[model samples]
Target: MLDLRSLRQNPQAAKALLKIKGYDFDTLRFEELETQRKSLQSLTEELRNERNVKSKSIGKAKAAGEDIAPLVAEVGDLGERLDAVESKFHRLQEEYQAFAQSVPNLPDASVPAGSDEADNVEVDRWGALPEFNFEPKDHVDLGAGGMLDFEAATKITGSRFVVMHGAVARLHRALIQFMLDTHTSKHDYEEVYVPYIVNADSLYGTGQLPKFAEDQFRIDSDADFYLAPTAEVPVTNIYRDEILEAGRLPIKHVCHTPCFRSEAGSYGRDTRGMIRQHQFEKVELVQLVEPGRSWDALEELTDHAREILRALELPFRTVVLCGGDLGFSAAKTYDLEVWLPGQNQYREISSCSNFLDFQARRMQARYRSPETGKPELLHTLNGSALAVGRTLVAIMENYQDGDGRVHVPDVLKPYMAGLDVLDLG
Candidate 1:
């Protein structure tokens, strides 16, 4: 949520910045609400003052042995007027809050301007695409030797689901373990375990509710729990409504979780395989840092995610998301796209973002400022160190042999029990 004071102080400036994000911001609605709020507040103050004066007059008149019926009646009328004005003021305040929450974060000035992914600027590329003796197969076709089972997944659940068996299943678990281990042991992030289901407040704290509710899978029971879309929701909410000491300026956490998404708006895209699963696993990294250092933290976090791709020896590139491509709570974002021989293209495997203070403000996650001795919002950042399922896809597609076997990446051999090649026996 944006600071209402900032919008009130200079709405034109705010609107201009917001325009970069492709918002057709409504200035007139905001101005009209502000005008009504100020008017009602002024009226409420005047009425309260009149009531106080009338009460004092009544006391004076009683002491002097004069009738005070007219004074009492005047005070009662003022009280009613004050109540009406206050009621209207509260309503307008709520409206303003809804308006602010509905608006997405302003894009950073450094972000490139564009309407969609086509406009995103690539930053760097790594590794080299694999050479194949025969036509390369997609993960679906490559995992067809009883290793990846989509038919069973569909019957047990529905479309956009898959069940991995044998070495492929082992590979899936290995990917999660490898990612968590690397992030915790080498990336300086604390490992954390969080609930897979979360309440609405937790979702709202992370800017997921009200705006993206349709994209979530909510439980029907009274708990009103929703399956987490990403570990970012629960992990980041750990500091919601908290005030941290200055010394703990930066907190880093890495978590692995099963993410569930409705994929509500997407249809007929990437439906052939696990590329757009309703359920997927991810290793998520989150950081909360002091305001001034968040931009630097963004770079470090992006590099940490890139390290995983490098470790897997996957051909990939990093791109800065344009204004239209930015996430709801992110001021800026970098998407890591890994080369997929099957698709013959690069697909997103991770997204690292600097939300600045956008999410902190929503979460009420703050730290006491040493300079001002007051609580100030902290900056929050999160990224998929790598999406486990997609990494699995990349490995199978990139490491396939002409004999229809997949060789495990060197880094994952130990996790795969030292069996280098996944040959269907």
Candidate 2:
């Protein structure tokens, strides 16, 4: 959630910044609501003060040996008025909160001005795109012979799903392990195991609720549980409604979990393979740091994600997302697009974002500032160290030989128990 004080103090500046992200700040509506809220608040306070004054007068009348009936009746009336105004004030506050929650975070000043991914700026590229003498096939075609079974998955669950068998399945698992190990050991992130299911509050804390409800796989239970959309959600929410000491300023966690998405908006895109799936594993990296160091933390975190791609020997490029391409909660974002021989283009393998205090404010996650001796919101950052399925897809497409065998990346060989090649023969 945005700081209401800042928005109230400078709605015009906020409106201009939000416009870059494709959000039109409803200043008129906000003003109307704010006006009413202020009026109701003022009335509520006045009534409470009047009631307190009148109630005290009733005691004075009683002590003076005079009939206190009139004063008692006046106090009762004031109490009734105060109750009505307070109730309205409470309701207006809720309305204001709803409006506030719908607004997206303002993009950072450093973020480039653009409307979409086409305008995103590429900052760096790594490795060489694999060259294949034979015509490279997409993951769907490469994993055809019972290795990547979409048909069986369709029969069991539906579209946008896949079941990997034999070596392909092992490769998928190995990618997860490799990513988790890399992030935990080399990147200094603590490994965490979080629930695959979460509540509505958890979703809201991560800026996925209220706006992207349709994109979630919500459970039918009365408890309002939803399938984890990404490990980022559960992992970052570990400090929801918490405060930490200055010494614990930077908290980093790496989590591996199965992510579920309804893909409600992305109906037809990437429907052919594991590129888009209802169920896919991911190795997610999350960090909580003091406010001043967040920008540096973002660079460090993006490098940590890039390390995984580097270790796997995958060619990839890093692009800074433009203002309009930024995620709902992120002030800035860097998307890592890995090269795929089959697709003949780079596809996004991970997104590293600095949410600043946007998510921390929403989660009420804070830390005491050593300098001020006061609690302040922490800056939260998270990234897909690598999306496991996409990494698997990249490996298969890049490592395929003329004979149709998939050579495992050197980094994952130990995780695969010395298995160097994947042959469905």
Candidate 3:
């Protein structure tokens, strides 16, 4: 929710920012509504004050043994008028809130201006793409050594699903565990286990509701609840509607969970392998920081993701999203695209964003500043440490030998119970 003061203070400034986001919020109408609401509120208060004065006069007249009937009747009539005005005032406030919710956070002036992803500029690329000897197999072909069964996945559920059996299944589990362990130990992130089901408020707090609900698997209801599309949903909402001490300025958390998505519009993309899935495991990182620290926190969080990829020797690049490509709640975003030989390109595996209090405003997640003894919205940030399934895809394709076997990454060997490679014949 935007601060009501934004419009009350400067409706024009709000309108200008909305334009850059491709939104033309009717500033004129909102200004009119605000003015009308204020007028009604003032009148309602005025009626109450008058009723109080009338009641006081009635008491004085009764004490003096004078006629109080006229005064009493006037007070009763005022009470009815006050009730009517109060109801009207409440409705006006509701209308104002509804309009504000439809408006999104203004894009930070620093954000690049563009119309679409094609306009997104590459901020930086990390690590070089690998040079392959022979024509390498994609994840699907490499895992087809009979353990990774896409057909079985489809039989059990539907498309964009995979059933890993035997050693492959173990490797999948190992990857998630390894990620959680690494993030918790070296990254200073407290491990958290969150719900797979979340409410509409959680999605809205994370900016996934309203616009992307179609991409989610929602449990149909007016009290809208949806299967989480990512651990980001539940983890970020852990502090929803709460206040904290400034000492807890930056709350770092790591969550590992299975995500569900409808993938409604992506009917034809990543149709093979686990690259695109309705269900997949992932480890997410979320941070709640003091407003001024969000940008530095974004850099640190993005690096935390790259650390996992680097540990596994996977090449990747980081791209900054353009204004048009930015997520609804994010002022800025950095996407880490992991190298996938299978797809013959880098694929986005994680997105680290600086919401700059955008989510905090929605969730009312605040911290008390001792300096002024006032509550302030904390900046919220979240990133995929790595999507476990896609990283697994990267590993299998990038580490496949000329033979049918796939060598596990050196760092992941311990998680595999000292097994260094997976042999599939």
Best by TM-score: 2
All candidates: TM-score: 0.93, 0.96, 0.91
Q: Rank the candidates by TM-score, best first.
A: 2, 1, 3
lDDT of each: 0.91, 0.90, 0.85
Candidate 2: lDDT of 331? 93
- Per-residue lDDT for 1-425 in model 3, tens only? 56778567887897787677677879789889988988998999899888888888888999999998887776666777888999999998888777777777777777777878777778778777877788888978887778889998789987788888877888889888888888899999999888899998999888787667789998878877899999888988989989999997689999999999888988898787788899998899999999889989999999999899989888888888777788777778888988888788888899888888878888889999888899989999999988989988888888888688889888888888878888866
**Which regions of candidate 3 fall more than 4 Å away from where they truly are?**
51-71, 220-224
Report the C-alpha displacement of residue 143, candidate 2, in angstroms: 0.5
Instruction: Residues 52-171, candidate 1: write the lDDT tens digits.
Output: 787888999999999888778756656777788888888888887788899888789999998789889999999989998799989888878878889999899999899988888899
Error of 2 at 27 (Å): 2.0
Error of 1 at 189 (Å): 0.5
Report the Cα lDDT for residue 102, model 1: 92
The root-mean-square deviation over C-alpha atoms between each candidate and the true structure, in angstroms, is 2.8, 1.9, 2.6
**N/CA/C clash count, model 3:** 0
Candidate 3's TM-score reads: 0.91
Worst 10 residues of 2 by lDDT: 73-82
lDDT of 1 at 201: 95
